[model samples]
Target: MSVTAVIRKNSYFDSVSLMSISTKANGIDGVDQAFVAMATEMNKAVLENLGLLSDELKAATTSDLMIVVVPSEGADGDELVPLVEELLVRKAPAAGSAEVSHRTIASALEEDADINLAVIAVNGAFAAREARKALDAGLNVMMFSDNVAVEDEIALKNLAHDNGLLMMGPDCGTAILNGVALCFGNAVRPGTVGIVAASGTGSQEVSVQVHALGGGVSQLIGTGGRDLSAEVGGVMMIDGIRALAADPGTEVIVLVSKPPAAETEAKVLAEVANAGKPVVVYFIGGSRDAVLAAGGHFAASSADAARQAVELSSAAASAPETLDAGQVDAVLARLTPEQVNVRGLFCGGTLCDESMYALLNDGHEVFSNIQKNPAFQIGAADSSRGHTFLDFGDDEFTNGRPHPMIDPSNRLARIVEEAKDPSVAALVMDFVLGFGAHEDPAGVTLPAIREAQRIAQEDGRHLEIIAYVLGTELDTPGLDAQRKALAGAGVTVTSSSTVTGEFARAIARKGAAA
Candidate 1:
């Protein structure tokens, strides 16, 4: 193996561009791994962890762009430097067509004082500082960067609250304000349903469902994932509820989160009860009765939340589509006796949690890398036992690489591994579509899905690949086309994660009984 590093002096690219370049380089033949990033301290640490850092890279300043590549045995490593340069050139904006760019919050504000929101996507260590500048300039914040200190988040939120402004997140990924999608958001029609979610994909899933149900969204607010915890006190949740309640365009408000602390849940429920507008709450593992008792509708899943929200706002309802009993039976009958367990590899953490709960509710002994119960937690992320569900988008899997949403390479590799296991009965996954997500996610994974199926078939085993695509028809990578691509690959594609999980559970139960 060989390692190479190049530092571009005084050159800078956004994190997303660097991540895309790194992902592209890592996918190159004979390349073991790659790191393309600004020389920020956080990124430097990532390079060190990957063992790709060099003395030159260590001395590089944050203004420098660093490209490090590791080549596997027998690989022509010399091509790496030229390849990195080529990718950078291709990714850069055209010389004469470049739009105006801002180097600081003050300068951006100077250019457009009407700018109401600032979306921060810098390194975590510098995120808070930039966010504070934005807040000081009277701008609402949508922080797309993670790894921010909790104390900084608390301080920023409190400051926003004091100024009667919104501070969305330090790790928030998706939000739609008025009618504009921001940072990792989807394009949906403007309507009466409004959402405030703590999970990125959760917001997308519910909003897309609302669109499909003939309803539109007025606003979508993301409070980051930690807003509902005891430490954060659900500050943004209550504020978002209040804001939407007062917005004349929003007839119904929906709240989504994985689960909240007891005190935080109670506080949010109190706000929901008092809000003049009807509320739909979908706390993935929270008590449904609690929401009802608080004068709100409780949804069983993200799709259900959107359905109920639409029903309340416009008296429209869309029945969830799921596989019939016969379809389930046929899939089970085709599986070999050795294929008895279900393997769920997901890019959405909330979806994975919801799937695990759905399987447990259906009386399956499921394990997951993200499960809170040690008994049900997989001992190793790379290994699966029993009916296992893994979140490839988790921080543990994304430490040095781009998120699975932006780069599906890791999940694709895992899919192949799961298919090779004789005990794997089914492979269930999610494909997220949006502005910052992969352009052609399903197209990229189609080959891997075919290969996995072929590997299973060659061993005289059957593999059931069930998936759900989360996005609206209006997204760049059209939802319909993505689903069509998956379906064309002989994969069962659904519209909801809940339905997908239920289908996988049904197959697993039937296979076990067989």
Candidate 2:
């Protein structure tokens, strides 16, 4: 009998098991055997893990294309009828290898992304296949596309390691590598600080802190959102650190995340202890007890970690230094009345809010997560004339699509446009790149600064572009290159987002020198 399979619309799965295909009276063939085996494996929850389907409850809902897995040649018309019932959609294409299905999706995107960065969105077979292709191309791949087979992730990451590359997530939400902003928001400077984080937001906070201390990142690697799970293990984490240790540019290491299984934590910390660099560690809400036993220094707060990373990155001959809130207050106290409008643009959702939250005293107002959320997908403004904290995720610049990490056109353009605004004196930004981020962010970034300079010079307006970048990740497109690019632009680059905030505050209340 000829069997039919339906492909669902809006589906992100490109790896559908094609099963078998033949005519009637012939019985099962290779395609049939393969399809049946794939179906029998029965791990629908993988959809959720891969970020293909955000929820697990609906993994089995298939519909768009009608695929017929015929048993063999000829067969029976009666069997064909039964199998045909599974078919749907008049626009179906003939079923073939999974590779062909992926190309179909790619053709759809080619019109938009073409061969360049404007490519908008791709779901289903295309996003998956191209995601794999991107990994093969050695780009820092951060897939919100979840539930990928563990084996696939291992293979992807192993291949990346072999090529001296890094892969942040099969479910990685944030990464800052080579001073290029990816999926997350942060305002870090180009400095000696390096980070390998398991939590997306944790690295964001740390990098911001580093920038605040007049420091920056060499690279910031994200190892999926959960690297310490007994099931997920720390394979990527191990590969990431091993790569970082070999990097000549990274002088200091910072590890940040939530606590993991005791064994997993031990495995990660043991490596940190032996990394031969001063490691500043923060596993949020983790037992201080575990850190004490780690034999490495523990940071009680993100701010402390940032300060230490800066001190260590700078080749300080002593313990890291500190700039108290009082010192910060003192810096702010000198600001004149005209410079109260500090504008911050970031990619990390949590870091954006944290900066807003920190700066939000009496008169200060903030706008967190400004870009990705549907409400502000286009643009937004805070009626308040106070300080503003905005998030322009790699995704929010939907000139065509999301993924600010991979494409810098929108943010870079915004940098030039926003510089022209009358009220925008101090501009705050974050640069994150990794195995999962854009290939060479600095290549796209420097020109924007040059243009912003042209506009600033044209108007004779004193514009300050303050930024923090995270570049210390285990990848071939090293973060150091991006960091240096930003520095060469003569912009104020730091390592921590909070310090970037402070720098913005100084610029907003002060002027171009900040």
Candidate 3:
């Protein structure tokens, strides 16, 4: 194998675009692995871990763009640099077309006075400054950049609250405004239900579920993951609630989060009581009684939250989707008595939490990196015990690498690693399709899935892989095609995240009995 590094001095590209370039480069015929990213400290550390860091890479400044490739035998790694450069070339507008690209927020607003919202995706160190400029310009802000100081977030949110404008996030990853999906969201249909969520995947799962149930969303607002923490105090959640309540198009509201701080929860619930519309609350492991007392409906899961919101808006209940009992039995029949553990390698953090909760509620002991109870936490993230569900998008896994959704390499590697264990029987995962996510999530992960199964089969064991594709028909990659591909691979594809968890739980339970 040959390793090559290409460094461009003082070049900068957003992480998302770099991740896309990296994925494309890895798809090259002879490339074993590729890294296309800015030479930041975190990224350099990632290169070191992979043993791909050359002296040139180490000497490159953070401002420099780095493209490193490890090519297979007989593959010329140097020949691939031109192809990477071609992908980096930004496409210009068609001849005679009147498209304009502005370099600054002020320039954009000047070009179009109707622009009311500013989407900021920059380094966290400068994200606050950029957000402040937007808020000062009388525009709503959705900051996709994480790592901004908590104090800066508080100040910016307060400024927006005083101005009666929306401040969506410091690390907000999903939202739908006026029926338009923005930054890591599904193409959901518009209707009477509105959502204010502090969790990204939780919002996608709920909104997609609503669409599947003959209901649609009026709006899906994101209040970055930390909005409900004691420090942030649910400022944006309260703002989102008021906005949705006042929206004539929104008749039923849904709130998604992983349990807010006590005082923060009270503040948010107080707003819910005054929403004057039906509100469905799902807080992972929150109290149902508190929601009931607040005149809100408590949801048991993300899917349940969607169902309640849809039923409230449409006044019609759809029959619940059921797990295929015969299929479950067939999968169980193939499993050996010694192979009794379920390992979930997920790209979506909220989906991981929801699945863990499902297994725990089913009287199964679940260990996870995100588990709050110390008893259920794993000593080492690299190994699994009993039923384990991991959120690969967590900070530990993503500090230097892109999210697993953006780049499935880490999760794909973990799948093969877990399959090597003789005790593993089933694998659960999620394929999140939408804007700003992987272009072909299911298609890209298929090879790894097949490889993992092959290893188990060669060892006289059967591995069952269950997955849920969280998307809609209108998504860019299209949900049907992704599902079809996975099903064709002999993998069990469930209808929803909750159902995926339930299905895995059943398989694990059956394995335990055997």
lDDT of each: 0.86, 0.55, 0.88
Winner of 2 and 3 under lDDT: 3
> Per-residue CA lDDT of candidate 3, range 80-125, in tens?
7777778899899999989988888999999999999999887676
Q: What are the per-residue Cα lDDT tens digits for candidate 1 across 1-514?
A: 4888888999877666776887788877777777788888767887887677788999999888888878788776678678767888844457897466778989978888898988888878788999999899899999988889999999999999999899999789899998999877898888999999999888988888888888899999999999999999899989999899889999999999987899999999999878998999999888988999999999998778988898899746666565577778778789877788888889888888888888887778888888877888764355888899998878778876788899988888888888889888899999999988988989889999999999999999889999889888899899999999999999988768778877887877776687
Candidate 2 C-alpha lDDT tens digits along 15-78: 2112111111113222331121111112233322323222222434432322223344554434
Rank by TM-score (best first): 3, 1, 2
Q: Is candidate 1 or candidate 2 better by lDDT?
A: 1
Ranking by lDDT: 3, 1, 2
Please identify model 2 stretches exceeding 4 Å from their true place.
1-143, 146-171, 174-198, 204-303, 306-339, 361-363, 370-386, 394-400, 473-476, 508-514
**What local lDDT score does residue 278 receive in model 1, on the 0 to 100 scale?**
91
Displacement of residue 432 (Cα, Å) in model 2 is 1.7
**TM, every model:** 0.94, 0.44, 0.94
Model 1 alpha-carbon drift over 4 Å, by segment = 9-12, 27-32, 40-51, 58-64, 71-79, 89-98, 379-381, 511-514
Summed over model 2, clashes come to: 85
Question: How badly does each model clash, as a count of residue pairs?
Answer: 0, 85, 0
List ranges where model 3 is wrong by over 4 Å. Answer: 54-56, 315-317, 375-381, 511-514
